[model samples]
Target: MFQGFNLNVSNESRFDSPSTYDEILKSREDNVRESLENFYNEEGLLNGDSLRKEWFPEIENCHVFISHSSKDRELALKLANWLYHEFKIESFIDSTVWGFADKLLKQIDNKYAYREETKDYSYEIRNYTTSHVHMMLSNALNSMIERSECLLFLNTENAIRNISLKEDREQYTFSPWIMAELQTSALIEKKQSPNSQRPFGSLESNKTDIESIVKRAKSFQMIHKANVEHLNNITCENLSEWAKDCNGEKGYNALTTLYRDYAPGCR
Candidate 1:
């Protein structure tokens, strides 16, 4: 499966080599930087500021932000790894640090302990409703979405559901984090280009949630009708057919297709 996805097969060797997780992450980061540099050099824009400016007028940093439910962290990581190795496209998933931090915060009540230890009335002057940890997480996630060239939402039935209640009908809500990322991406996209037709895309093995989410997004003017594609609709009987149809001639897989739709001029 890894070979079919074009991931680094040597990862098995590395796993056997006793490398630390931090070391693996560092190596991946270095590989991404090298790949991007090579891409820029091949395009003759490595040293030409003006040429680079013209080539990427709107996109400053080209990277994909993968938004998925915490329950699907492993699947999200697999997709991100495939994206980096196969397409040389940098992808970001917040679970690496966010999940760890969240777990640590839950394990230790340091924030509340600090508040009690200080007892400084002036500290209460802070206006945020949520805890400091949550505020930091929200900021970090919003920053990632803002910096990303495209937001690829991994749609699962668990992540999104249709609420039939009248109160919920007025405002469509998915997983809180997913909703935040989508809204943040939409805000950034609108700020950058108010007239952009589609600011994001979604992928799902099932169509029910995708259709509902897309409809809700369009009703709120977050995404365009033509921007989203149902991946299951494009499946094929054979591998070659799958590659040709699902993965386009230029190798626009489900994720890359979203990036292309949002940023046409981006490489």
Candidate 2:
């Protein structure tokens, strides 16, 4: 185990050396976020041009939220600067010193025309900033979901993993010791993604939730019908074009039947 800097990875930390990917992750969880910072240092992990041109509230331009356990502020700041240098990523760090949200809201309220209305806007701004900070934490934990990606997690476990830290009581206590929000994001992606096959069976056998599937089917039907009609309309520019020749009803029925057969809840 390569031990240096402020912290040391003892035998109790994990097996042997940081040879495998999981071992590397487990080692970095020990308040040493250097590994996490290094991952994003990749050449094109965060493409500034594409981020600005394609993604809204662009990562290349927008500030990232950095949520750190107060004890790990130094590591958080180091990580934040790392992001800024490589991808032009602006990181908002929340630390024991000062959570960025409160500071940002104060700045915003100071500039707001409505002094009395600042109270409500203050609350809203504060919440929004706080949310980003939390998002930063979540993103660090699950590298699979970029804060940019349409990865919407409604119900899930906290992104950070618990680490046993010796406390004042001389006993072990589990704390959120994770520093790599990106790795955590990756893990979440693993969970959210559909793995076709596993040792036990396919994902289909154990499925429960179906609303998202139904909604997807409905959306696909709409897109498919529109594409079909558009192609036909472009191919034949007749003034006498009518629905009877277009098979609009049949297309609708086929789409409806196909959806009903598989998507139970689609209306």
Error of 1 at 132 (Å): 1.4
Tens-place lDDT per residue, model 1, 77-163, is 665554454444555676654543344333233332224433321234333323544555667677666666545565554445445
lDDT of 2 by residue, 1-267 (tens): 000011111221121222222332233233322112233325636343232122112122223344344555544445444333333334434332133223433443444421343222344654564464445433333332233221111110122232333542221112232233322433332221121122110123323433455367445411000011101111111201222233333222322332233223332
- Deviation (Å) of 154 in candidate 2: 25
Tell me each candidate's TM-score: 0.46, 0.22
TM-score: model 1 vs. ground truth:
0.46
Overall local distance difference test of candidate 1: 0.42
Off by over 4 Å in 2: 1-68, 76-100, 111-187, 190-267
- Regions of model 1 farther than 4 Å from truth: 1-62, 103-108, 111-130, 167-174, 190-267
The superposed Cα distance between candidate 2 and the true structure at residue 114, in angstroms, equals 7.7
Top candidate (TM-score): 1
In model 2, which range of ten residues has the least summed lDDT? Answer: 222-231
lDDT of 2 at 89: 35
